[model samples]
Target: MAIGKLFIGRKVRDIRQANGATQAQFADMVGISTSYLNQIENNQRPVSASVLLSLAEKFGIDITELSSGQNDRLLSALTEALSDPLFETYSPSLQELKLVTQNAPGFAHALIAAHQAYRRGNEQLASLDDRLGAAPSQEVTPYDEVRDFFHFVDNYIHDLDLAAEQLATELKLGEGENYAALSGHLEAKHGVRVVRGEAGDEAIRRFDPVGRILTVSRYASAPTRDFQIAIQIAQLAAATKIDQVLKQANFRSEEAVEICRMGLYNYFAGALILPYRSFLTAARDLRHDIELLAARFEASLEQVCHRLSTLQRPGLKGVPIFFARIDRAGNITKRHSAARLQFARFGAACPLWNAHQAFETPGRIIRQTAETPDGVRYLCIATQVSKGSAGFRAANPRYALALGCEISYAGAFVYADDLDLSNRGAFDPIGISCRICERIKCTSRAVPPLKRKLVVDHRVRNPMPYEID
Candidate 1:
């Protein structure tokens, strides 16, 4: 549709033919004339963008191929896949995609396809309940997967818990300075050297297993780098135990099990870096001041929030908190919690929370009180942290992590003690059910969560205009 468009009609025709469809047949399928299709294939008549879209819908192809005049099937699949809701928020922004297309087209294509496959598998699994009608066979929900992983960590508290305690003792970190001491101790005792380097173009940090060194970006704070080192050590140290647990999980595929295992190891790494008990004590002492905690632990704000959610130690659990990490555009990258909060399996987050606000302030913590339609209320605190192997330039992507707990647990920590929490202004009501959210007063909802099916109230038109039910 743009000027000097590269017409890929011939490529489309070839793909159609390969699929055993003739020009007439394909034209019929796409609701177009065979003659028009012929013109398109021969490149005689330019295929407008709309026609290309229709043709893609007909052939199950991607419009990118026709637009770009390329015949890369993988790239086409990738483009189509990225449009999936699961990746719509998390995928690189348009500018980043342009850079990838201009500089690293291959990697861009791979990433898109990989994400598409990842989301496709998840979507298929999610639909199993309706398809199977409560079959006794299916046992693994995303919820269950999460629960099992945390269980594994709870069972294997030896390495991470003991290491942090032992290091604290040996380094004589005493009351306030154990974080730096822990970093120095790890470097000296474990031979796990840490160095500051440019955030590489692929990942935030890289652990050289053969070299036994961690190359962390200079952009990372001391605590963040130390956390990375601790996580890597935890991963390597607990690899065997993790593998054993995953093997017993009897997952359908080795790939799935491996992915789960790696994720669990990273969770443990976070735990080891911010040992739960000490951090909880510090959290209580500091009134959950994230900045103070970051300063004390030498960890990034994101790291501290993440570790906070993992304080669920069964009988001795701290406040149950829901933790979510999101990019600038409201794409959730990580979510974990024992708290009762619902999130879209394949979409953006509710826009009212402090997590989105934290992006504007970057390093500063933002707090909010929100009430869900189901009457659940929470206190959320969030801050933005850097990610990627890039600088603060256009290339460096920032992400926000928000940690929240029900209002009943508000007094258990020091997150938002000064706010007039009892007043309505002090509380920003939100909902866990996206589609069913009955709050007609909420201008932020993308779609009402399905659960909040509207019922008519003939008598009154309240700000929340849902049915009486």
Candidate 2:
């Protein structure tokens, strides 16, 4: 394989300016001519290996930081933002996006943020129209506000993750440790009593703060019980750390702040169960086998899949995957994407996705090679998970969990074994949503695309009522 040239012009210039050094002075420090350094800084030439070494030795800078700093994230966000119908006529090249991200990252981020806000505003208006007699209010739902916060952060909070990792270490928990250790830790360290009993009909876990009693439902599985214990621990012990992170978020309403607080606590709970380095190493060794990972970490399959999407630690990153859970009605209950795949914000996912079919075959994993309308290939896996009820009359919660990664990482997945990767015919065509899908000939499309005109002809017969143009 040929090694690609490293272009760190914007990074080099930023470093030099931050150190209060002129171009000539920085050039002299790096043992390069001023003109050569200028060219490198302007991206006209790649940074030499010797210059990288000199940067590490003289300026104590990490070489990896210069090349891989938020460019991938910015690129993914920019691509999704530009995919809107408003920008249908103009699409910038990848190189142009890279240049914009490298040179004016703040501007690029602001543009993405603006686009997200616009989309949110439009969604709110559409939601208001759906309620025929209801009066419109300026206040956005707290749930949506918090969801947007997680969406913008890419579903990973670095500080909370680190704090949870540190707490996990202090608990003296080892890899593959079960809930016994965690339960004992909470009882011994936090003066909290862990009890498993019927937590009413609707609640799975209930915490009595004043009495310091954490009651988990008896119907909950061992892994669910363990996770509930961890969540309570996060609420009780990590409240200060959670609050500190929440303060910096500057949420608009107290409800949003409270919702975000619980969300962060849940994030910490997940991290505490699956520490970054250990879980990542296990994931690699197991080829990201969800069941094996769940057993290894004493977590549920959904928990393992959710953790897989959060492996965004800067230097030691895992395969980028998207995780989603949908109900039988096709409602997306949970969604996060670390890949280029983005879920539809307002409606259900595409009907063609294997996730919708997972409900048909309960407890069996279904694998599919799916391609989005944008031509990106993915190795999608889905399985139906059912939460048991305590009694016969109670309703059990059922959902289908979907996890996928780009085809380039398919080789690292155990489910991809024996699959035909090169056969383009094996890949099923899917889309983000019907409203935004551009596949005009799709028989599964329920409605016409909002951005395309519908040509209705009474004499012509087609699968759809009208032709999309």
Candidate 3:
């Protein structure tokens, strides 16, 4: 196997600039000549191992920070952006994209911004026919706008995570004491009463601001109850911090700000349940076992999976995972990805993904070696999780949670232990959505690709009604 070159000249330059050190000063500190450092910073030379060690020893910087796989993320984003039908014939090769991401990251980000603007414009144009005679309207949904904000930020709010971690420490929440700590904090700090009662069939938690009472449903699991209490604590204690982050986001509408506030609260809750440093260390030590981690942290499987995707905290980053929750109807209820695989913003997910099959085998985890149309392979695990059972006659609310990481990191995941990673035939090919998928002969395809022509023949009927050209 050929070891890839570590081209971290830009990162080194960035670190030097952040510390307000001149190139000559940094080069001397790294024990490299100024000319050589200049060449390295400009991508003309690869970073040397000696220089990496010197910088680590002198500056107390993590070596991984200099070689973070941000280029891979940029390459994935660029590839996804170019896969749009608008650029069907102008796609760049993987190598070309890597070069752009490595050498000119700003340009790559500019291209992604342009593509996003184009998509927004195209969406507006598609809705033009519905408002032909009416006055022009600017009625974009704030929910979607906020979702895009979180999606673009990779679902990790550094400030909020740190704040929640601090709050958890202040509450002295140790392992298995998350619920008690949060409930006690709420009662003592805010003079609020925490009670569990028969919330109406649909209500999971209800808070009376004036009465300062937080009511949680008795039907909820212990983890859910803890998470609800944490959310209430966030609203009461961290509202100003949440508002600060929302203002930094500069959302267009008040509705977007409100939605983002709730998202930040939930983020705080997740952080409280799984403090970043401890959770990441535990996850690595346990080979990223969701069930074991949930048991250890007193959290639900869904919460663990969601927290896994938000572990992108700069120098202390963890594996980049993608997580999604879908209903039995195949509708994606929640989704986030720190990996290359992105879920479709609209419509149901591809039928071939094991996430859809999770509903059939409730409580049993299913492992899959799946490949996307982009040619990226992932080790995916899926299972059904449920909450809130009303009674013997009422069905609980259930959703399938799918968690995955790139195949390169599969060795660290227990779910991939018995899989044949080397055999190409073992991986199942999947797509983001039927409308955007380019697979011509997929038997499960519900619709033809957007820009491709179709061939229909009455005498030549196969699994699909029409053949894509």
Q: What lDDT would each prediction earn against the true structure?
A: 0.63, 0.83, 0.83
C-alpha positional error of residue 316 in candidate 2 after TM-score superposition, expressed in Å: 0.9
Predicted candidate 2 versus true structure: per-residue lDDT over 210-268, tens digit per residue: 89898888888888888899998888778888888788888879999999998998999
Worst 10 residues of 2 by lDDT: 64-73
Off by over 4 Å in 3: 1-12, 27-75, 93-140, 170-177, 198-202, 392-395, 435-438, 450-459, 462-469
Please give the TM-score that candidate 3 achieves against the real structure. 0.84
TM for every model, in the order presented, reads 0.58, 0.83, 0.84
- The lDDT-based order of candidates, best leading, equals 2, 3, 1
Encode model 1's per-residue lDDT on 24-103: one tens digit a residue.
88888877789988887765676676676776666666553344322222333334455455543565554444334434
What lDDT, from 0 to 1, does candidate 1 have? 0.63
Candidate no. 1 TM-score:
0.58
List ranges where model 1 is wrong by over 4 Å: 1-214, 217-220, 388-394, 424-426, 448-469
Candidate 1 lDDT for residue 106: 57
> After best superposition, candidate 1 residue 283: deviation in angstroms?
1.0
